[model samples]
Every structure is written in structure tokens, then in C-alpha cells.
Target: MTQHRKRDKNLGLAELVAIALGGMVGGGIFTILGISVSMIGNLTPIAIIIGGLIASLAAYSYVKLGLYYKDEGATYSFFKRTYPKSHFSAAAIGWFIIFGYISTLALYAYTFSSYAISSTEFANDIQIRKMIAIGVIGIFTLINVLSVKGMGKIEDLMVYTKLVILTIIAVVLIQHGSTSFEGFIGDMAMDAKNSSTLSILIVASITFVAYEGFQLVINAVSEMTNPDKNIPRAIYSAIGLAVLIYVVISMGALFAIPSEDIIKNKEFALAAGAGDVLGKMGTDLVILGAILATSSAISGTVFGSSRQMSVVAKDGYLPKWLAIRKKNIPINSIVGMGVMAAILILIGGLELILEFGSITFLLVSLLMAIANYKLRDKTNSSKVLTTFSILGLAIGGVLILYYEFTAKWEQMLAIVVLYAVLALGAWIYSKKNERAKKIT
Candidate 1:
């Protein structure tokens, strides 16, 4: 494909919202919700609520960063320019964050595989699972190879469809589902503090997962009609709806199955949520929602990751070839990112991938809070709310790290190792650049 293929422009508020909703509300929700309740027992809904607040705090930081920098790379470019010494750290972190989407991709691939295998009318064939996964990835890769506009339109449609699907499942569950509260809250072995903290952290992390797509909206800052205003608006709108949906779904899951059942069988998470209410059909619908949601997330990441690559190229951080834009799109970067993402789906384990990505994003969120503080002071604006927004992120980042370090230890360790490797990579890249300069 031609190197830099530009489209008409970036995107607008409507497109941005589609990207956010489409990206964030994916396989994680359907798969993780039941497990969460299983872990915390009856406190699952409260955990989701706690998670939602933390995620929103993080989202607020992104909103300010998007407003201040308004660049193509979103946080990576913004942080790099703001903290030049941390450029490579910025790039490495960016790589990690992309893995969140990569994890989602792997998850969807698995779900598709299961669905394809079960669809065999004659008999239940487990072998077909792998076949379906391979085919879905191949198909998704091809669609990604198309123009960015093609990807965006597909993301918008798929995400909305997923939402519709989720809504239908939810409604059916409400009407037909049955589970009393006392039964919903099962006897989980735990002390008060440990149980409460775990529940809170798990829920918080899951809610954060739901906000994953919001960063994607800002990635297309250059395309927005009024990025400064609309991007923030889009971020808020998408996150708001997501939190609402998650809360309701958590409640539904609690009511659908006994808390002990949720813990014992995680795969039955969504099925339990819809089983009594929507019957077998409702169960299938949630699963379908998960598949569609992952598709949306992958689409968002493909577009956003490529744009970050272009932003770095524009700054001379990487080869200008990567920055090449043809027909208004960075063809080189898009394909490069798509290829990398596809490879990741085949290899990197999801938890490790998510941690690595989360670390980078956490750092970016840290910088964003600082940037907002810097900008607010620099501009001397009266947007009191935005000022507090930055403050919340600063505190939120610390709590997130504490939770991640404790809850995701192995993944966190992997992240630290990867950080060292990326640090070495930046060193090599810099030395080569210095040598090239001396030769001239």
C-alpha cells in the first residue's frame, strides 16, 4: 500500500462517540462481570460502582489533555513534547497501552471460536473453535487493511449494534430473570477488609476497562470539528453511558444467578445474567454483544495506534517513512500497527499485555494531570471544573498503581521488564541518530 494515505479529514464528535462506545464496551464486560461477583460474592455491583468512579476520574484527565495538546498522538505525543527527556518512555508506554486492545482482540477471537463451534446444528464440535478463531482473525485483518474511513464506519455500526444487543438482553433479563437478593449474595470466604478491597479494586479495574475506548476518541483530535470542546464532550458522553450500562449489567448478573455459581463458573457469567430472564436466547445475545464489542475495540486501537505512530514520525522521533500520509491517512503506520496488533493476538498473553499497556497509560494519565495543572495555570482560565478534573486524576493514578501492583503482580513484573527493554531500544535508536549526525 502507498505510505501515507490521507482521507478527507480525521473525524468529528459523532464519530468520536462511536469510537469510544464501540471500543470500551467489549468482551471484558460479559466475561469479567460474573467472575467479579464470584470473587467479591454479593458485593459485585458496589465494586463496579467504585470502579466507575476511578475510571471517570482518569477520563477527566484525558479530557483536559485532549483539550490542551489537541494532537494526533493523544497522550504519547503530548507527554513527549511536554517532557522531551521522557520521549522513549512515552513511546514504550504507548506500546503497552495498545495491548489493552490486543487483549480484547484475543478475547473476541476466543468467543468467535466458541460461537462458530456451537453453531453446528448436527452435533457439538469443540475442534471447530480453533478454526473459527483463525478465520475471524484473518477476516478482521483484511478489513483493517482497508482505508481508515472504512474502519471508522464499521466501528460505529458494530458498536451501536452491540449496544442494542446488550440492551435487548438486559430487558429480557429484567422481565424473565429470577433470583432473590439473599441468594444472590453468597457465602464467600473472606475477612471484611480484604474482601472489600479486592471487590473495590476488581470493580474499579473493570470499570476502567469500560473507559478504554475514550482515549481512542482523542487519538483523532486532528480530525475533530472543534476538538477542544467536542472531544471532551465526546469523552464524557461515552463514559457516562458505559458506567450506566455496567452498573445495570452487574445488578442483572447478581440477580440472574446465585453468587456462588458466578464464582464457581466464570464462563457462565453472561449466561447466568440472561439465563432465567432471556432464557437461552438472552444468554446467546450477551455473548454476541461481547464479540461485537471486541471488534469495535480492535478497530479503535488500529486507528489510534497508527495515529500515534504518525505523530512520532512528525516529530522526527522515528523514520519519516512511518509518518508518510497518502490520501490523508498514514498508510505506513496503519499497516504497521495492524500487523503488530495481529501478531500480538497470536502470542502475548492477555493479562501481561493489559498490565504493560496499563502502566504506560497510567504514566500518561500522570503526565496529563500535570499538563492540565500546567496549562490551567499557564492560561489562567476560570474553568474551575477542569482544574479539579486534573486533581482527581493525580490522586486516581496513585490508587490505580497500588491496585495494579497488588492485584496484577506477575503482569506488573512483566511490564517492568518490558520497560527495561524499551529503554534499551531508545538508547540504540538515539546512538544511531547521533552517529548519523556526526557522519554529516
Candidate 2:
């Protein structure tokens, strides 16, 4: 009985929400804000809200499918099980989703390092920033490998504490802002008139990456209690909260800082701007919030994505060694993810990593939406919403691609090449799995 109790659910609603929020809020807003403001000016908040709504549509399908499948593998497992005969579908999604998580992991670690040294003399040193980013990944990888419950508790602490810091930073910035509410509204009107619809929509589509972490809750289905109730609860709640947090913080930044300054110091805009308004103290607060935000995100991503990686490896879609687990924890997968993310950071620029992650997740989520739409009856999902999800995600995917093609064809070519490689690897694994099955 004691053993049974010990083996029972280890995560609750709060922890689940934290994991989702941790994943969602991690470097997303910090990384996207300057770009969004650069593209749409004061209209960035509107784009962010639209992005959140699109994310909600994506979440509807994820929540429905999660409850129905209840697989800790979440995205990859759902597709694999839903279409049991399609080895390629399973293998492809497994590869894409794991690499998508790897990209975000690198994004978070890079963002963490960016803010960690934003105020220091080393702020301009790219090499030092990359080293710090890799170091932070190593720290969180160790934390995740140590114990699941400990990771959960640490996540809860970091996520909630960061929320408080972020909220305070928002309020403080708003209070000391140069632009009044009326002036801010005027600027929004002016920017809305000047910005093209496609540009605004493109910004909205780009902001979807910021909303990517809510699905991490679904990946924790095994560890959480009453997943049927908590899955939707934690996911929806986190996304909603994320949308609110992002909007508030963006509004505060717009009010306090000039758009050009934000665009100029895109990497650490908040810290750069806060120093002028809130002085050194305000900058410190912003840096602290960013560090905590990205830290929890790294922890949650490592926790959830490693589990999915293990699940995929166990099914022979990835290297077999990644399947090894110690005490139900995917220790090897966690370490492998850290190493891969570090290598990505070493080789890929920030923009490349960010765009790759956004494109991969959007494509994968679009596929998941289609799967849920097809399995609507079993998942008890709304066909109308599922269809909407499919359309919305499809549109988002296309918009990002269009943006890429028009703005940076070279990056688009690189992304295409990467996809080709991933597809080839997936095909090889699927073929191997088929032959083994036939032999058996």
C-alpha cells in the first residue's frame, strides 16, 4: 500500500500549470517583442492577442486528443496510435517534435544567457553568451535527471516567482512610462494605419512560437493526477494567463520605451529600455524576471520533451540508447537533448534557431490538428473547432513560410534542407522498423 501510494500521481494541477506556463513563457515574449514592435510598432499587442487566439484553437484539439489518448508521448504517440499502420507518420512526427523541442530548448538557453549578461561588460560578447547558454542548459539538465518531483517543485517556484517579478516589472514600467494611455492609443491608431495587414498578420503568426509551451502539460499526463480534468484545465489556464502576461508586458514596454530603441536593442530590449526609465534598479528587475522565465522554460522543456524522446526511441524511431530510463526518468534522453541543443546553439544563429523552431512546431501542430479532426468522434472534439484549428494552423504555417520566402529566401532554403534531412532519417527508421516487424 505504501509502495502503491508512492507510485501514484506525483504532479498536481498547480505543477502542471507551471510546466505549461514555464514552457510557453520562456524566451518567447522576450525574443519576439522587439521583432513584433519593429514590424507593427504599437500594434504588436494586437498581433500577440491574435496569436493567443490561434494558439487557443490549436489547444482545443490538443486538449481533446490528450484526454482521449492519455499518452505521455503526447504529440508523437497520438499520431502513431491514431493511425497505427503508418510507420512513417509516427517516425516523422517523432523526429520533428523532438527536434522542435530541441530548438526551443536552445532558444530558451540562449535567451537566458542574453539576459543573464545583458547588463554586464560581457553583454556584447557572443562567445561568452553562447557559453553561458550552454552552461545553463547543463544545469537544468542535471536538475531534470535528478528527480521528477524535485524538478516539479523547482519549476513551480521559478514559474510563479517569475510571474510576480514580470507583473511588477510591467506595472512599474507603465507607471513611469513616457506615453500616456491616450498617447499610446493614438500611436496604435497611427501604426495600424501605417502597417500593412499582411505585416501585422505575419507578426501574429510569428508570435505563435511564444505560445508554444502550453502543450507541455499534455506531455506530463503520466505524472499528473486526474489527467482527464487537469489536461484541459492546466493547458487552457496557462495559455490564457500567458496571453494576458504577454500583452501587459508588451504594453508596458511600448509605453515606457521608444519603438526604435526596442528595435535597435532587439536582443535585450527590456533591459536596455528599463535602464533609461527605471534606471539600474528597473533593468535589474527585468533581467531577473527574464532569467527566471527562461530557466523554468528550460527545465519544463527538458522534462516533457525528454519523455517524448524516450517514448519515440523505445518505439525504434530514434537511437535506441535514448530509450534508456532510470527510475522512470528519461535520463539519457535529457542529457542527449542538452547536448543537441548546445550543438545547435553553437552552429545556428539566434534567428535561424527561432525560425526553425516556429516553423517546425507550426507544421507539427497543424498535423496534430488534422489528426484530431479525423478522430473527432473518438476524442469527443468539436468538428467545427477542429476544422477551424486545422484552417488556422494551416494558415499560420503558410504565413510564416511566405514571410520567410519573401524576407529571407536563403533562410527558407536552409530550413527546407533541414526538413529534407529529418524526413530522410525518419524514412530510414520507419523502413528498419518494418523489416524488424516482418522478421518477427
Candidate 3:
């Protein structure tokens, strides 16, 4: 009884919010800032706001389903239970969501490596960055495998501290900016006239991946307290906070740093820009903020997604070996996720990983929205809101694909092939599950 009570109290609302925020705020802003600015120029924050709104739309279904289902498996478990009869649907979503988590893991680790080396001679050293990225993943994977409460405590420290630092960086950059408020607004107006509506919407859709981590709060349902209150509270609070942070930081960057430099530096744009404006002190601050952001993100992603992976494996949608657990922790799944993310870091480039993660999560969230609509009554979900979520998510998904097709067909081809491979794997396991069920 004592042990059970201790387990129940391991995570509270604060920790839950940290996990969600850690996941959302990590490498996302750092990774996408350069790309968004290059595409939309001064209009990046508007796209960010739209992305946040779209994320909120997607979150409705997750919150409702999370409260109703109260399952730690989160996206995979919710979809599985929602359409229990369709094994393929369950298996396919499981595959996509897990890989989506993997891609984001790679993204965060890559961003961490970029900022970690941004001030060093190895700033542009691709091989060294990849090594550092993989190394950090291993470190966090071991921490997660060690203790749940330990990881949560560390995450709270990193997430909250990074938020404070990020806010300071924004204020300093804006104060020391080269452009005044009027000038910035004028630049935005020019960009608005120059950039197309479709371009802005496409950027918004691409930024959806930055909002991908909020649903992670629901994944901690088993570990947290007061699911009825904390689930929605944590998820919504984290998303709102994320939107504010992204906007403030992006505005600061645009005000202080030139667009050409941001485009050139790409992943390390903030750190590079900070060095120019604030010198060593400013650059160091940005690097510190980024490190903490991506570190907590890595820890939170591995923690939540590994548990969900274990759940999926137990359901016979993945290798049964991954279902093994110790002390209520999915050790095998945790290790497997780290290994797979490392492999992705090695094979995929930064942009490919970013785009793939965004598209996959957008698609998975869209499906979750559809599932919520199907069981709206049971979940106490409003039909009007759920329907809107469906339409918004679907449009977001379409916009992203359109951007890929028109702008980078080669990346689009790679993404398509990757989906085909995952589909094949999901199909094979789903059939195996069918046979096992019939025999039973």
C-alpha cells in the first residue's frame, strides 16, 4: 500500500505541465525559427499563432479522449480503444505515432547538438554534431531507465529554468534590436504584401510539429494525479505557454538578427545572432537556453513515448520483445526508442527529419481528431468543436503535403517511401495479431 501510494504521488500537476512544456518547447522553436523566417520573413509570428490555434484545435480531441479513456498509452491506446474492431487502424496509428515520436526525438537531439557546439570550433562539423546528438540521447535514455521520479524532477528543473532564460533572452534581444517597433511592423507589412497566403498557411502547417509535444501530458495519465483536472489543465496551459514563448523569441530574433544570417546559420541561428548582438555573454545565454530546452525535451519524449511503445508492443502491434518491463518501467521500449532515434539522426538530415516529424504528427493528430468525432457522445466532446478540429487538421495536413510537392519533391518522395515501409510493418503485425486472436 505504501509503495502504491508513493507511485500515485510521483507526478502532480506541476510535473505534468513540465513534461508537456518540455516536449513542446524543446528543439521546436530553435529548429523551425530559421525556416519560418526565411519563408515568411517578418510574418513568422502570425504563422506561429495560427499554428498554435491549429494545435489547440487538435488538442480538444486529445483532451476529451484522454479524460474519457484515461490511458497512459495516449495516442496509440486512445485510437486502439476507440476503434477496437479495426486492428489495421489501431496498428497503423501505433506505427505512425511511435515513429512520429522518434522523429521528434531525433530533431531535439540534433538541435541540442547544434547549440552545444555553436560556440566551439566544431560549430559546423556535421559528424561531430551527429555524435554529440547520439551521445545525449544515450545519456537521457539511461536516466529514464534508472528512475521515473528522477527524470521528472530533472525535467521540471530544465523546463522551468529554460523558460526563465528564454524570456530574458527575448527581452535583451528586443531592447538591443537594430530595428524599432515601427520598422519591424513596416517589414511585416512588406512581407505580408510579398508573401502569399498559401505560403503563410504552409508555414503554419509546418510549425504544427513544434506543437507536437502537448499530447505528451496525457501519456503521463498513469503516473500523474487528478486526471480529471490535471490532464486538460496541463495540456492547455503548456500549449498557451508555448505559443507565447515562440512568438516572443521569434519577434526578438527578427528584430535583432538579419534574415539572411538566420537563413545561413539555420539550426544555430539564435546562438549565432546572439553572439553578434550581445557578444559572448548573449551567445552563451542562447546556447544555455537551447541546451536545457532540448535536453528536457529528449528526456520527456523518451519517457512518455517509450511507455506508449511498450503498450503498443503488448497489444501485438510491434515486436513482443519491446513489451518487456521492469519495475513498471518499459526498459526495453526506452532503449529501443533511443537506438532508433540515434539511427535516424545518422541517416536523415535536419530538414528531412523536421518535415517528416511535422507531417507525421499532423497526420496522427488528424486521425485522433476523427476518432474523437466518431465517439463524441461517449467522450462528452462537442460535435461542432470536434468537426472543426477535423477540418482544420485535415487542411493542415493537405497544406503541408502541397508545400512538399511544390517545393521539395525529393523529400516528399523519401517521406512517401518511409510511410510505405511503416505501413508494411503495421500490416504484418496486425495480421499476426488477428491469427493469435483466432487461435485464442
Candidate 4:
């Protein structure tokens, strides 16, 4: 009880926002900027704003249900409690959400490696980058295994400090920008005339993963002070801040760098842009910002997702060994998640993991919107808004499938196969757990 009090007292609104922001902003903007710019040029900010709006729509359900149930199991447990008798529903969401976290884990670690080695001669070496990605995951996995308080403090420092560094990068880029606002507007207008609406919407749908980590806040419901008040406040505020940061950074990048450079250096575009314009110092700063961003994301994802994984295990939807906790930490679950993420880093390509994570979260968030609409009366959710959330997320999902089907059928096929395997495992566990519960 004393320990519990200490945990609650140490975390407040600031820490809660930090956790959410740490999760959302990590490696997402850095990775998405090049991709977005390639697809939409100066219109990248429009796609980002659309993604954030979609995120807010999804968050409504999370905030309402988070306040209602307040389970750190978050996506998985919330579905379980909302539909108690449906073991399959619980198991499926459990599998999807945990794997989604794993995919994002791989994404962040890979982004970290990309920026960390951007200045090195080994920049183009894929094998070396994979090694560095796995190494960072190992480092953060150990950090998470040791202590939650330690992780939180480190996360706080990284999130805030990175924000400052990112702001400075944006300002410096804009100040040194060769393009005028009028010229940018002309470029955007020309691009808008040539680019299809479907393309911009597809880019927005692709960026859903960038806003994926804000729900990590809900995973800390037990540790927070006045969760009923803080959960919604932290999640909404973090999303708002993230949208602003992403827009500023995207605009700044476009202002300073040519579209050809962004598309050419797609992987490390920001760093490349900084190198060309801001010289070595600008390049160094972007690298520093990316490293910090991805590092904090790795920490927060491991910290929050491990707890949710443990909760799912406790409910008999996963391996029971993963439920074991020492000092309120899910050691086995944390280790297991790290291993899977590392494996993904080694085997899966970055674009595959990125799209998989984006689609997985969009589907999961869509489910949350449906769940909330079902419980709207109890959660005080507005009918219009909840319905809009459902419509918005559904459209986002369709756009992703359309994009994948047209652009990358191979990756889409692989994602489908992966989901099938996960579904089979979830079904088997759901049946086993149901039988065990009946016997008892």
C-alpha cells in the first residue's frame, strides 16, 4: 500500500502527458516526413492534421472507456470487460494490440538506428542498421526490466528535451529556409491541383501509426493521480501537442529542403536536408532529436505494453508465464515483447512493419469506437461524435486497404497471412481459457 501511494504521488498530469507524448512522437514524425513529402509534397501537413483528427476521434472512446473501466490492459482488457462472455473477441484484440505494439517497437528501434548511424559511413548498410536496432531494443528492454520509476523519469527527460530540440530544429530550418511562404503556397497549390484527394487521404491513413502511442497514457491508469480527470486531459492534450509539432516540423522541412532531396533520402531525409542546408551542426541536431525521440518511444512502449500484455495473460488469453510480476513489473512479458520486436527487426522490412502497425492500430481503434458507441449511454459519449469516429476510422481503414492493394500487394498479402496466424493462436487460447474457467 505504501509503495502504491508512492507510485501515484510521483506521477501527475505532466508525467502522464510525457508518457503519451513519448509514445506518440517517437520516430513517427521522422519516418513519416519523408514518406509524406514524397507522396504529397507541401501538402504533408494536411495529411498529418487529418491523421491527428482521426486520432482524436479514436481517443474519445478510449477516454470514455478508460474512465469507466480504468484498466491498464487498455485495448485488450477493455474489450474483454465490455463483452465478458466472448473469449474469442478478447483473445483476438489481445493478439492484435500486443502485436501492434511489437510492430511499433520495431519501427522505433529501426528509426533510431537510421538516425544514429546517419553520419557514419555505414549509413547505407542494412545489416549494420538491423544490428544497431536490435541493440537499442535490448538496452531499453533492460532499462524497463529494472524499474518503472527510473523508466518514467528517463522518459520525462527524453520527451521534454526532444520537444525542445525538435522545436529548435524546426525554427533553425525555417530561419535558414531558401523558400518563401508565397513560393510554398504556390507549390502546394500546384501540387493540390495535380494530386488526387485519394492520394492525400491515403497518406493520412498511412500516418495513423504516428498517433498510435497516446493510448499508452491509459495503461498507466493505476499509477496516475485522479485518473478520471487526468486520463482524458493527458490523452487529448498530448494529441493536440503532437499534431502541432508534426505540422511545424513538416512545414520547416519542406521550407528548407527540396522535394527531390526528401524523396531521394527517404529513410534519413530530415538529416540529409539538415546536412545540405544547416551544415554539419544541423545534421547533428536532427540526429540527436531522432535518437532521443525513438529512445523514449522504445522505453514507453515497453513499459506500458508489457503491463497490458501481463494483464491479457492473467485473463488466460496468453501464456500464463507472462503474467508473473516482480515489484509490479511484468518481467517475462517485457522480455518476451523485446524478443519478438528484435525478431521483427531482423526479418521484417521497415515499410512492412510500418504499414502493419498503422493498419493494426487503425483497426483496433475502430473497434474501440464501436465499443464506445455501444456503451455511449453509460460513458456519456455524444452519439453524433461517436458515430463520426466510427465513420472516420472506417474510411481510414478502407483507404489503407486501397492503398496497399494498389501500391504494395506483396506486403498486404504478408500482413493478411500474419493476421491469420495470430487469429488462430487467439482462437486456440480463448477456447483453452474458457474450458479452464468452466472447470473451475
Where's the lowest-lDDT run of ten residues in candidate 3?
A: 1-10
lDDT of 3 by residue, 1-440 (tens): 01122454588999999999999999989989989998999999999999999999999999999888888888998888878899998999999999999999999999999999999999989999999999999999999999999999999999999999999998899999899999999999999999999999999999999998998888787788888999999999999999999999999899899999999998989999989999999999999999999999999999999999998999999999999988889999999999999999999999999999999998988989999999998999999999999999999999999999999999999999999999999999999999999999
Candidate lDDT (C-alpha), each: 0.62, 0.92, 0.93, 0.91
Q: Pairing residues by index, what is the TM-score of model 3?
A: 0.98
Taking the tens digit of each residue's C-alpha lDDT, what string does model 1 give over 1-440? 01323335646777788888876676556556655665565566666666566567667667766676667777766666567675455655454454444555555554445443332451144345434555566565566556667777887789788788777666555445475544444432242345867446644554455456678887777666777678878888988888777767766666666566666545445654464566667657766776777677666766776777777666555666878876666777766665555565565554454444444554556566666566665434345655665565555556656766887777667667766765676555555555665798
| Tens digit of per-residue lDDT, candidate 4, span 117-164 | 999999999999999999999999999999877888999999999999
Colliding pairs, model 2: none
All candidates: TM-score: 0.82, 0.98, 0.98, 0.98
Better candidate number, 3 or 4, judged by lDDT: 3
Cα RMSD of all models vs. native, in order, equals: 4.6, 2.2, 2.1, 2.0
User: For all candidates, what are the clash counts?
Assistant: 17, 0, 0, 0
Q: What local lDDT does model 1 show for residue 125?
A: 47
lDDT: which candidate is best?
A: 3
Q: Candidate 3 regions off by >4 Å? A: 1-7
Candidate 4 — which residues are off by over 4 angstroms?
A: 1-9
Question: How well does model 2 score by local distance difference test?
Answer: 0.92
TM-score, structure 1 vs. true: 0.82
